[model samples]
Target: MSSGTASSGAGSDDDHAPWPSPLIRDLVDELRRFNRRKTEFYAESVLEASAFAIMLVLSDGRARTLRELTEELGLEQSTVNRQVNNAIKHGYLERFEVAGSLSRFVRPTDTGREAFHHDGMLRAARIEATFADLAPGTPEGLLRELRAFNQAYDRRVLRETGKDVEATGEHRRYG
Candidate 1:
């Protein structure tokens, strides 16, 4: 949250340094903790953010097929399928066939949803804690900035893998 400017030795009078935002380092560290060498939950470490993201979009709490998950995540069908399979095996998800469709539908079980809810609340609390002393308008400004960042993220995912997936904020799934 340090907004103060610093000048590089490269020497302009301008205080605009070209340092990468600390947010990047912070995020990497946090995610690395989840995948640290000592971690026992390999499945959680491998679970695709996109798959969990797809679950979040299922406001109805009904099952969705890989096709539906892929569309929601703006990801490839195979990627969605693989992640769904992994999730199912982990007991965080279950699959059932649609009445008329050949493809199987996936839904998070109660345990799965509980885990998702826990992660969501933890993240929300962290964000709130991070910005606790900011002014009211600061939160809104940060929200706007985060939205802009996500648009850029979506663009990058599309560029790197031809996917336009998206997610944000309190990280809530359905009710």
Candidate 2:
């Protein structure tokens, strides 16, 4: 018997061949994942961008406790606390205490809104435009999906309250 790596096999692009190159869809997905990591890394260095996305998700015109934010972010409380503190320090978030309650609310300040939009949202919109060329579906289809979701969210918000102040607020609260 000849010595060779069993996993590698004789190189062939057949379906049964272990060495067959990854399928086109798999390759595309891989590239997308890689791009996401690279973009996140770049954004992390930008301070405001690192926190903007999380803050925007949190400040969807609703109050979320710090524990809730930590769970949503998949981060430790200390980490969330530090970021929240920085947000407060930077005038991006304000702490709301209900006195003797474990739940404390953190809401975005005006400056936070500006920083979030200028830091991450602006970049994301431009990048999203570029991503239109990456996937199989047309950009129009993706936009339609977004609009549908937005409409659904709006309906829910309106149902909950007579007035809807947008589910995701007008801007991201940089935290």
Candidate 3:
């Protein structure tokens, strides 16, 4: 077994298989740690992480149909519907229909916008404080690398799924 790899204990052939590159394994581990720490930061938040994500997507004050939200978030339609309904129940969002359209659009209410902004600021402050001792420009460099990695990952996913960026409307956001 590789020094850093864990065994399944069953002694199957898979256990002796070559593991992923160290860099990949380390990146995965760090991502898991980051997610756990991020959850802690939102433990006392007014909105759950999923709810905050929905609001973030709509933070520009533009209305989006549930389909659009689902596509943008890469979440199931039912999941998006439930989150949007919950936001509406909390008076953070509203669903309205255009006079001639059957599709309904969801938009953030005044209260929702205020709450989103306040929560976002608090989260940002916590993150900034956590990384305060880092050398200048470190955060910007990290963000740049993260964005590049995400774009590359997204492109790979599209290629493997045989989907085009235009078909998924990802180009609008990622491009």
Candidate 4:
């Protein structure tokens, strides 16, 4: 048998052949290619990808602790703290104590909220313009699959890191 062909069973057919099927490989490759546009957009937008991602997560006006944000963003605690500190320094975020605990909540300020709205609009326009040529349901289907991919990725991350990120299982609507 060739190295690429598996010898799992005497009667097994190509249907159950082996690891990394063509569909899986193709999906991974396509995701990598699609991610390039995101990287390029962030590069041209003058905001670091990390910062932008952080802002997007916080755009819902729901205050999240540093640890919560770190796990959600899948970034190191120190990195998230640094970004939080930077946001605070720039007046984009405010950190307040949780009354009786040392834990603090980082919430966006009015200016930060405005920034989020502006960024959301810019991103929506960019995506709309880019996918305007696609069929009517294509973009919606892609968004649904992307959300599923994100959940799977988060699950894998939790298994590897021992940190659980709460999955809302629902997409946040942005206007």
* Candidate closest to the true structure, highest TM-score: 3
Model 4 earns a TM-score of: 0.68
lDDT of 2: 0.61
Sort all candidates by lDDT, best to worst. 3, 4, 2, 1
lDDT of 4: 0.67
Off by over 4 Å in 3: 1-18, 36-44, 135-137, 166-175
Top of the candidates by lDDT: 3
TM-score for model 1? 0.52
Local distance difference test, per candidate? 0.59, 0.61, 0.74, 0.67
Mark the regions of model 4 whose C-alpha exceeds 4 Å error after superposition: 1-19, 36-39, 42-47, 148-175
Candidate 4 at residue 175, lDDT?
32
lDDT of 1 by residue, 88-125 (tens): 77777888776788887788887778766765565556
lDDT of 4 by residue, 44-125 (tens): 3534455567778887768888887877776799999998888778777898887777789988887777666676667778
Per-residue lDDT of model 3, residues 1-175, tens digit only: 2334444355554443354544454556667766675346465577767778888788766788999899877789999999899989999889999888789999988888888888887888886886796666466787778778767877998879877655554544421
TM-score for each model: 0.52, 0.55, 0.77, 0.68
Best of the two (2, 3) by lDDT: 3
**Candidate achieving higher TM-score, 1 or 4:** 4
Model 1: how far is 69 from its true place, Å?
Answer: 0.8
* lDDT of predicted model 3: 0.74
